[model samples]
Target: MKAIKVAILDLYDGHPNQGMRGFKEILDRYKAKHNLNLVYQVFDVRGKAEVPDLNFDAYISSGGPGSPVDSEGSVWEQRYWELIDKITACNQQADSVKKHVFFVCHSFQLMCRRLQLGEISLRHSPSFGVLPVHQTALGRQEVIFEGLHDPFYAVDSRSWQVTHPDEDNLKKYGAVLLAIEKERPYVDYPRAMMAIRFNDYFFGTQFHPEANPVGMKAHLINEEKKQQVISEHGERKYDEMIERLEDPGMIRLTQSTMIPNFLDQAILSMQEA
Candidate 1:
């Protein structure tokens, strides 16, 4: 069998954080566990002028720190747009082989903007910690959600989200909303789109399904981050988050499945092609 060529586009300009490192480690484990030849490479897409050729079987984009629309006109954003365009073109040109794309957080926002499938804007209150999200009707039938819970927990820490998604646009582009935020008690938050699928070969999650829960626990409790959370959301909210993160079942169930499922689907697609 040919080795699955996977390209991980690291949008972070500097050193990858523990969460990013954890994601890579999980991918490596998946490669070994599935007994598959997986060749993984990372590219820094911060200031590049050209999009590298879309020759990989699967492409994954990492989350960054801000709104994708706000980063418009910057070199990094331009390159990202170019990369997506190339991927779309490649899929269009290919008859039997379709390159797969998996976007996380910021990249998901960027994809939504580039595709014009929704509006992206700052959230009134940032979502942080393991959020409970429920799959839509289409999501339940999607391959990625197979063997996963109906309502699953996923790590989230973002100030921007897809709001008022254009359903018509999504369908026109062969995209579908897979999951959305479950309402929280007493919290009148806007309904945020949690996952999206563009055709059979492209998918994205607004939450960090790639995030390692144990690593995320440590990340949240870091002195600097903890202090920031307390200052921003109040001590009570910070305490609540800390308590929620301690649930071993939620953490384990949330972190264990997403990447593996994505890899399984991508590998099957390659083999069938």
Candidate 2:
């Protein structure tokens, strides 16, 4: 059995943290379950490294805290555009081979940056919490959602989002809003779309299904609770977060349910192609 060569694009700032580790965990778990030979590598775009051999089944753009569209001289923002352009070219050229792309958080913003639809502005960002997501017709039908239950839960800790892209605009941009929020919507941002599939091979998520319970709490809650933390990070109630993380049933269900389905769909797409 050959291992799936998976390239994980890490665009985080100086220090990479647990959320990044969790994504790798997702890949590791999938490999363990499916007898997959998985080659996972993280590329820190902050330095000089020509895009390594991208001869892989999939390319994943992991979530980061920075906005790729920011004018500030962030090497990551620059690198993102470079990578997307390359990916688009690969899709067009022969012998290059078309591959699947999975974008998380900042990576989603990178897609928007390429399409010129909208950049993630901090206009009305949602505070951290467990957000309920509703699947669109496309989402329900997409391979990423195949065999998954409806109203799937994902970890959303991002501030930037895909802004308003109407149907025509979305089609023009070559993307679709596969999933939306039902309850506890991020009204200000309202999560442009939880998932989008491009050309049947490339897809993205606004939420972090790669996130484990502990990772979720740290990314979603701890970061957002800056105000609370400034006044009372330790003092304020962290019991809810603790309960959510410690709950074996909840954690197991999340891990067992969503990501496996995603991995299966991705691998199937490669086989069928």
Candidate 3:
């Protein structure tokens, strides 16, 4: 079989702690574990005038720091929106290869906003750290969450979230809400949407399933970031995050299955095709 080509839409431009690296590492592991042929390419979409025209079996959108709404009028944002439009258009064609898209964090918010399936709002306080998320009734039936436990812990860092998801709109689009926040720990905001499925081939997650626990520990331990977290969420929360990072089980519980499951599904699809 030919190698499965995958595209990673990297939103962060040369950040030292880029999440795409973790994603690539996870996918590479998956390929080796399954003995499947898979290839991936990264496209940095920041300040770009045009999106790349390349054919791929799957696309993964990486998370970035910043509010997606704040970037609405920017050149990079507009270009990305156009790119997503093109992807959506292609998916609508009968002859086109079914394109799979996995959106994370900022990209997840962007997709929800563009589809008009949810409301994105700024939170009174930023959410940063591992959070407990519960699978919805529909989520339990989804293949992506297979073998994963309920009330799993996943890394979360966002200033905004999908506040009031339009369930009617989601159903109209043939989408399902996969997961939701178990509790509103910060800002007393209502429970936030954790995951959603727009279709069989498109999904989004509000948390960083690609983030490695070791990498997260390194990122969180940076002196500047530690102080920043302390400033934003106080010293106690920061300390808790440090403590949580030490437990490998806690880090591996929820996030380890995400990319692997997505890739396994893609492989199965290709084999069937």
Question: Quick one: best lDDT, which candidate?
Answer: 3
Error of 3 at 58 (Å): 0.7
Per-residue lDDT of 1-273 in model 3, one digit per residue for the tens? 687888888887556554887898888887888787788888888635435564778888888877778777788888888777777887787776667788998889988988888888997678888777899998999888887778777888888889788978898899899999877466566888999998878899998888788778888788998898899889999888888777765656555688788877766665666
Give the better candidate number (2 or 3) by TM-score: 3
- Please, what's the RMSD in Å of model 2? 4.0
Considering lDDT, which of the candidate structures 1 and 2 is the better prediction for this target? Answer: 1
RMSD of each: 2.2, 4.0, 2.2
- Checking candidate 3 for backbone clashes, the offending pairs are none
Candidate 3: list runs displaced more than 4 Å: 14-16, 94-96, 185-188
Task: Give the poorly placed runs of model 1, Cα more than 4 Å off.
Answer: 47-51, 184-188
Write candidate 2's Cα lDDT for 1-273 as tens digits: 767777777766545555678778888888887777877787775444324455666777777775566634565456656766677777676554467677777777677666665545673634344455688887777766665567765556666667565566578857777887554444443446667775556777777767788665665355555446334424333454455556655444555655566666667756765
lDDT of 1 by residue, 160-257 (tens): 98978897899799899999998766876668899999777789999887777667678878899899988887888788767767776565666667
Worst 10 residues of 2 by lDDT: 229-238
TM-score comparison, 1 vs 2, better candidate:
1
Q: After TM-score superposition, what is the CA distance of residue 198 in candidate 2 from its true location, in Å? A: 2.8
Q: What is the Å distance of residue 93 in model 1 from its true position?
A: 3.6
